[model samples]
Target: MASTSVSKKRKREAGDDAKASFVLSTQPKSQLGPVLANFPSVKPSKSTTFSCYQTGGNAKALGDADDAEFAELPTLIAGETDSVDFHSANQPTGCRYLVGVHDKKTGITTIRPAPVHTLARDVKALKSLEPIAVSVLQRLEARAALGETFGTKKAKLAIKAQERNKVDVSAMETVVDHLQESIQKSTQALPSKEEAQATADSTRLVPPYNAEATVPSEVYPLHNIIPEAEWRTLAATPFLVVGQMQRTPLLPFQRSQWINQHLHSICESSSPSKTNIKILLYISYMMFFRKFAIQSNLGKVVLEEKLASMSPVVADGLLSRFTESARSSSKPQFTSQKETLLLTHMFALCLRVDDYATDTELIARDLSQSTQSINTLFKSMGCQITKLTLTDLKRLGLPDGAAGTKRALLKVPLEFPKPRGKRRRK
Candidate 1:
């Protein structure tokens, strides 16, 4: 019985060893790769696009009553600067411009861009007409001077042309008077009559005006956005930007927004709406004499935001540009590189916008190379050097209310204190 049991155990052991050997021989070789089954290759459909929260989240107001697509983008959140995407190197420590949206709650002033469509005044269309209006004014003034020496016939013809183009003599006179005063102060020779004649293009259309006060629609127009009293005050004097100054007379970002809103109106309207042309000539004039600072960090931010939002192509182009540099390549997207790029681009664009500046590329090159300071750049462009007046600061988006008013007031001390020697420590 013992001998039979031993033989059975031996047979069992032999069978188990044989099975192990067979499994070892059947195993895949090192080069045979992974043994797990491969998933079927997923062929992405051409029409499909990937959407994420931060990317394609904003779709036009979702139709359903229950569907609440957030209407407002949250303002810069607390500790947003700590995000992995934020690169602080070259992030400017201070901004040149004083204009900012002051939050009364925390007393924090942020670069909170105001909607350009507000103020119900068509500053954009007006802005476009300002130069032509100026030209008509120049021709009128020239003819008027010549009419004094020559005859009223020439001046009459010029006035007729002004009337024909729909240019307002009142507004034109205000601007011209300011300009002449500026030229006189600078002691610069006034533009020659022949030069004015050479530059004049009578064919240009003068921007139209709104004679009728608009009734309140679903949206507020000029009526509510600007109080009648406030409008009257501003329109009364209309402190015109007559010449270039080292300081920016008008904010480029604001003007850009206005321009965009105006262009959009032109595209959307079957015809140019009165809304499009209402505040026309004034904006043109302000922009005409406003300084464009190449070295301004604020301008940098504006330019960057503009490029980023314009289209993916522009953003991609910017990325491609800075990515070449090792320093820029490693830094996060929201970095100084963008600021630098934007600042440089703004400077270039400003130079390009000046019809007077023939060598715009050279000027842009010098600025991009850091050979010119922002102050110097604008000064070279013949901008008048002036700080934001109390009126302008108040006109900009500051906090409201009597207490809010004084606290938010951006008044610089009217008088300077006499310099004193340093205090001697006891």
Candidate 2:
């Protein structure tokens, strides 16, 4: 059995002759009594309960019960202050209706009919549209339910069958051809190894350091001398340090790669300048070929032999600058600490020890200076002219043959002396 409840919300306007508005709605039920009553044989299954509530201006609630029979609904007349709600129920199969006072003056009631709802029209429309066949729909449903696991057991066999019969190589051949063409074009556009080496050597004004020789124990005894900041600067042009002083042929890429890997830490720590690159090259040469120079001439080689054999470009530039600075009437002064240090290295190689005392005789002759000025030069470099003894020779790892002879040694310390300040005229 179907049951219904209708509620009316009444609102009164303020005034001695105020207007009132009421809305009648069947709560939780369709208004089907009038439509089903048209068929006299059909009887309503239940009755609808009606409730009226007044809000604003003497708010109160009024309620009543109505029969399921087709009784006429009451109309609201002007000056009829009482609000009533009427309801009825039949079969649960009709559209809803909204009843309102159409004209308060004439006491006429009106209803705006609700749209009819039925599934018959929807079913008819669905029948007109095309739909998947039952077999295809069932297949789609099965695939959705199975997800990724669908047909997985047969996947390998299907793949083998496709590879055996349905294989397509033409597209793959086209892609391979395109890739080959691209690679050929790329190779053609690049410079050959010989040509790249020639170009690099052309701009080179100085000889490259020998990479195979051991770095000097004094300069970089334990680890790299070049600091991280200098290494970053050197990285920009590793090719500059890529050739050999003896003109030994090397693989085009091997020298720089070895330098980056092995000698990166062995480079000198110095302030960056226009001469930084040259200074680094000087340090690298001394570090690598110091043993050769020491062994050959007992470390008494002349400037020409040292320059021509070791690094022509750097030696010539340094000597030119040194001679120019020495000729100035005022006492000699180095432009940079690096220049002074480089000179100290050059002189250190030539200093013959007469029992730990430096023999500056050859160096003094080469520079056209007296032994006293040569001594001053060594002193400026923080070296002490001392006598070389058997114990000292042993410490220096000198050969056994030199044990009987006396030699002069120059002691060069790690840190240089601070340059003396110029004295003011009194």
Candidate 3:
């Protein structure tokens, strides 16, 4: 009976050893390799009843082992337990673990191991690897949390910004239109007759006899000079031409004469002895021209014409005279043909629209009064005026009939006078 019992015990012991050995060897290489490498010297403790072992400050136990070789068994079991813990700990939580069976005949090696929270803690303690592990986990979590990719978020933001820009552009256009209308109403109320008579009297006191006194004695046909039928077309919205027409007399020629007279008077009165006269003249010219251009029908009509009609030669000559006057007046030199052209063009365009001349008589009257104000301002600055050429007039886009007449009067063939012989030494 004693021999049979010992035989039974040995058989059972062999079976358990076989099971543990098979588990350590037959498991997948990915699972077993790291486990064995990290805990190669694990050992079982003497006080433990089961196959208990310590590895990396962690302990694990298998089945009880009575009368076993504790001294050698501790080391063997420790090594085995560490191997199992390492391999099992690395497996995903959902993966099945093979903890029991030994042979292929049984085909039942798969067994679930108990939760190994301690091994997980040990893995976390590896600071060097923690970042990589955390990064992988975070990526997985993020993928699960956010269904959309980074590109989608960027596109959404870009679309929102574009929508905002469109709103701002529309608001700006509305504001511009409102300001333009207000200017028109204010310009209609200016005093017309008083301003025109004042301008005429001032001109009589200056050189280049006033056109009213010098023109052909035969009443220049004033009939179609400004067609009555064209009055509606010629008149602009009140404030639109205030700066260009200066004041309207319902006649384009009359407006032109008024501007010319005012400018001439300003120039004749300025003395050559004044210091910085050039600077004053330039400022005065700009202020007057800008004001008149803004109010004049001629100023408006000329601007509406195409660029081809603005004779460059005439424009150049007029600019040269403007510059010369500034220099002669002893003022700061004001040069730049481009700036002059741009200002002239803007003035012309402003007057061409009907909005600036809706009430012709009213606008003309306002311009006349404003001209006096403008002249007073210029006189205060001590500026002398210079005559602008027909080319300059053409740049303003005056009517073809007016432009042609002026061109005919101003045009002259270019010629060079013969050079005299050099003087002989005395």
lDDT of 3 by residue, 257-320 (tens): 4233333333344342121222222222334433534454222234334222223432333234
Winner of 1 and 2 under lDDT:
2
Model number with the top TM-score: 2
Compute the lDDT of residue 113 as modeled in candidate 2: 36
lDDT of model 2 at position 96: 48
What TM-score do all the candidates reach, one by one? 0.16, 0.21, 0.18
Which candidate leads the pack in lDDT? 2
Model 1, 146-226: lDDT tens per residue?
665766676668756766788566878768978889878886655676565434422111111121323212111333222
What local lDDT does model 2 show for residue 109?
50
Better of 2 and 3 by TM-score: 2
Q: Quick one: ranking by lDDT, best first?
A: 2, 3, 1
- Candidate 2 regions exceeding 4 Å error are 1-312, 315-345, 351-358, 395-426
Stretches off by above 4 angstroms in model 1 are 1-311, 322-338, 354-426
lDDT of 3 at 111: 38
Model 3 misplaced regions, further than 4 Å: 1-91, 101-110, 113-334, 337-350, 353-426
